[model samples]
Target: MSSVKERFLRYVQVETTSCEANECCPSTPGQKVLGEMLVKEMQAMGVSGARMDEHGYVYGFIPAKGKTDAPAIGLIAHMDTSDAVPGKTVPQVIEHYDGGVIRLKNGVEISGFSFLESLKGQDLIVTSGDSVLGADDKAGVAEIMTLCEKMLAPDAPDHGKICVAFTPDEEIGRGADLFDIPGFGAEFAYTVDGGALGELEYECFNAASCKVTVKGVNIHPGSAKNQMINASLVAMEFAGMLPPWERPEHTEGYEGFYHLMEMSGNEEAAELKYILRDHDIRKLDARKQMMNTACEVLNKKYGDGTVLVELRDSYRNMKEIVEQHPEILERAKAAFLANGVEPIVKAIRGGTDGAQLSFRGLPCPNLSTGGYNFHGRKELVPVQAMEKMTEVLVTLVSVK
Candidate 1:
């Protein structure tokens, strides 16, 4: 059987960075490439029906070991890496770390912080200094794949049918947008896409994307006077209207924040993009209303057409949906404990595909793949963690 770490290394070698610039499904062609690769791998592993959909989603089926009443379970992970940094480079596996400051190519160094102590005797998969390690969800993908391989063995333990799905464009928050829950044929699912070891998340932030546009009159500086409205200044003023203390850097746990993602403009026009998040639906609504109010007050000062804000709901907290079926959580906790890993339950400060899936009637929750410092060059995963998580996935799908 191929180790989960080896499978993860193979998966990350494919460049699957999702693009926000593209409005198309899957976001980038690289995502399709990875999905196709996964489908082939699954088919080679005996999932003859495995296939990649037109939208770049890959699905595979594992029939029950014997006819039984156990509910079919689904395991999900994203195929795409984050677009925040370059993600084409394959990872370098550092074997049996001494926990010192490990140096990489291009003069980049991986800081051996106190966290390194935990993995002192284990192998580590790290970046080569030029790109992200792609362990964010790829590790999750590998773990699920390894589980499939194990479960497919002739002498494997008896289990219920299992569904496996690999999605694209998760980095851009569209992972669950095109997901076919009914077709997946699972009573409930779990997304293997959290950080650190043993992290479990059922609650996630209620999310929204906001775009504020400012229309300003541009005139000659000498003749500008009261006739000219600086769009850049107006955009800054609009940002200023938000509470300074409430931002991603300042908030934690259940706190809500308004993140100013991007702003670009000339005096004639300007646009600001923001992502608002809160753990509570009521607070999320209030945050959106606050953004609208900010625009309203600014428009009142600068004229009716000067400021315009557009707010769109993205996803909601999954706690309510997840609560309805307590067995999912209980089973997951049992799996973790069975693998000798302690479960750490926490609310995700950001949203996941599981959050949207839960809302879509899947009652999905998030689980960790034992990766840390994701979406950047410093991303790394321990070999032991991947092995343990693979065991957890096997336990999760097996009939108890």
Candidate 2:
């Protein structure tokens, strides 16, 4: 059996960074490359019907061996890494970590995070400080693949039908957009894409994308007195209208925030992209209202067509949907406890593919891949955590 660490190392070397600029499914060609690789790997592991769809989604199933009556369960993870950093990573494996300041290439140091102290004596896969480690969902992919390999063994315990899927463009928030729920053929599913060990989540933020465009007249500084309306300054003013403390860096838990993701412009026209998130639908609406009010306030001062705001709903909190089926959460908690890992039930401060899948009638919840500091240069995953999660999935899918 191939270890999860080995599988993860092999998978992360493929550059699968999803681009938001691309409108097509998968977002990047590298995603399709990874999907093809996963499909081949699944087929080699004796997975039935292993294939990659045109949209770069890889799907396969393992039929019940001993227990044919149990409900079919699906395991999902995204194949693409975040576009925030480069995806072509050089992973460094640290054997028996001493729990100190570990330095990487390019003067990047992994320290100050309290979670590191708990990982002492365990092996870890970290980045070389040049690119993201791609552990966000690839670690989940590796664990799921390992689970399939184990469950398909001749001496393996009895399990229900196991359906596995690897999606693309999850980093761009389109992972569940093209999902084939009915064709997936699972009563319920779990997205193995959370952070830290034993982190299980059902609730996520109600998300929306906000774009503010400022149109202003630009004139030479020598001749400009009152005629020159700086669009960049107007954009800054619009940003300032938002609560200073309400941001991703400031808030935690259920608290919502408006995160300004991108801003670019000169004097004639400026654009600011923000993501609004809140667990409460009512609060999320209020945040949208606040943005509209800000636009109105700015337009009333400048002109009618000076400021324009566009708001689009992204995903909703999955708590209401997942709570309807308590057995899902109960069964997951049991699986975690069976593996001697204490389950940490918490609301995700950010959204996941499971949030959208739950509303699509899958009742999907998020599971931990034991990776931390994702989407950046310092991302790392513990070898022990991945092994334990593989065991958890085995117990999760096995029939009594």
Candidate 3:
């Protein structure tokens, strides 16, 4: 069986960054490339049904052994990495970390992370400052593949029906849009796409996307007094109306925030893109109302039709759906304890594929891949944590 570290190091070399501008299913060609490779690996491990669909989703199955009557369980992970940084990487392995500042190739330093001190004396996998480490989901992919490879061994532990899937474009929030839930053939599933070891999450933020457009009349400056209306200035005013303290950088835990993702404009027209998130549906609605109020204020100042806003919901909190079935959480916690790891249940500040999957009748929760500082150049994952998580997965499916 392949170690999780070996698999992760090999998989991160593939460029699978997802693009938000593209409306395609996979959103990028590299996702398909990774999916094809995963399917081939599954087939080589005796998974006869391994295949990649047209949408770049890879699926396979492991029939129940020693106990055929158990319910089918699904394991899921996305194949795409975040577009926050470049996807191509040069991996650096540090053997026996000394718990100090880790300087990468391009003068990027990894420090000040609260979890770094706890990871001392363990081997870590990092990358050069040129790109992200891709541990956000690829580490999850590697761990799942390692688990599947182990389950197929001759001395493998007893298990029920296991369904495995790898999705694409999760970074852009479309990972579960084209998912075939019925065809996935799982009573319930778990998305192995979280951070830190021993993390088990079932709740996530209710999410929405907001777009603000400012339309301005531009006149010749030579004869302009009150005739010119600068759209960029109006856009800045609209942004200043919102509470600056309520943002991603200032909030933590269950505190909700409105994140300004992108803004571009000139004198004639301007556009601002934002993502709204709150664990409470009512709070999310309030955030929407706040956006409307800002638009109304701007339009009142610059005449009618000057400011336009578009607010659309992306996903809801999964806590409402996951709490309906307690057995799912129990099984995961039991498996963690069985592997000598205490389970840490917390709410996810951002949404996951499982958030949408749970609302779609799958009751899926999120699991960790022993990674830290995701979606940036300083991202890293411990070798021992990955190995321990693979063992936990083994016990999770083994018949008790």
Ranking by lDDT: 2, 3, 1
For candidate 3, what's the RMSD?
0.9
For residues 160-254, what per-residue lDDT tens digits would candidate 1 score against the true structure? 88999999998889999999888888899999999888999998988999999999999999999889999989999999999999988998878
Per-residue lDDT of model 2, residues 1-400, tens digit only: 8999999999999999999899988899999988888888888989999988899988999998786899899999999999888889899999999999989978899999989999999998998899999999999999999999999999899988999999999888999999988888899999999999899999999999999999999999899898999999999999999998998899998899999999999899999999999999999999999999999999999999899999999999999999999998999999999989999999999888898999989999999999999989999999999999999999999996
Clash tally, candidates in order: 0, 0, 0
TM-score list, all predictions: 0.97, 0.99, 0.98
Candidate 3 local lDDT, 299-320, one digit each (tens): 9889999999999889999999
lDDT of 1: 0.89
Sequence-dependent TM-score of model 3:
0.98
> On a 0 to 100 scale, what is the lDDT of residue 226 in model 2?
82
Mark the regions of model 2 whose C-alpha exceeds 4 Å error after superposition: none
Better of 1 and 3 by TM-score: 3
